[model samples]
Target: MTKKNVDDYLQEGMYGTRLPKEAERKHFLGTLRERVILALTIGEVMSDRGLEKLETEMKKHPNSTLLMNGSVAYKFLKQERDLADKYKISHTTISNQEHQTEIGAVLTYDHAIDKEDIYLSNDEDQEKSDSVEKDDQKDQGIVERIKSWFS
Candidate 1:
């Protein structure tokens, strides 16, 4: 008989349990770094207890810089939900503002500053140096000839 795969094993002769939703999966895979940063930023609004809980939740993830945006969004949403429930405020307000701020931070951090600006500046300096060297060479030839005659 053919070997069964993981899906077959999971199904056990019936359809496997429904897979996690896309958003759920994304949220589940969010990075610790993003979560910590989010917590710190939000701590400005949340209580020490809330911040502690958030930090505890973040500790469950591996410490690394490679956090995914979807996961970060998921963590933010979760925190916002918790804070809203705790403080009796509209979750939408915090979520919307945090979403905007997070989006801006992610865009800024992910983009690398181009080195072409420094490179172009250095090239200009090099051209100037080359021109000075040529001028010095021309001056040296005539000056050297005069010195030789005087000697």
Candidate 2:
């Protein structure tokens, strides 16, 4: 049999498998929103206070994900294996264009969503909510408002 082409798979509904459904897309976006604010706050805290401060903060909570530079994480792990092992802290190295040395606790997506106010600053949350409200207002046209009024 001949090899199936892109069009053949598209016709068979095999393509776009990675695309999320409407509800899934909304959930994913909300999760990302929480993670972004958490990460940003953590980064700022870490930068201002250093890794030791971050460690002290993380010690308050169990199973919080910690992000650090690869080299720093390696050295820290080698030097403090006992502490790391005791806390069961997961060490993750993020490599990106931004030059930063970050080490702080992170909440899971679900936890962040449930505790968004705790994770995100008031200003950040207000900004995001305001933008969302604007988009919603834009979505509701005059016709839709009139229909709602009658109903």
TM-score of each: 0.24, 0.33
Which tens-of-lDDT digit does each residue in 17-73 have in candidate 2?
444343432332222334322332434443442334334545765565544334333
On TM-score, the leading prediction is 2
Best by lDDT: 2
Q: After superposition on all CA atoms, what RMSD does each candidate show versus the true structure?
A: 17.6, 15.1
Runs in model 2 lying further than 4 Å from the true structure? 1-37, 41-46, 49-57, 68-86, 96-113, 118-151
Q: State each model's CA lDDT, in order.
A: 0.38, 0.45
Model 1: per-residue Cα lDDT over 60-92, one tens digit each: 322312222332345444643454345443222
Query: Which residue pairs overlap in candidate 1's backbone?
Result: none
Worst 10 residues of 1 by lDDT: 102-111
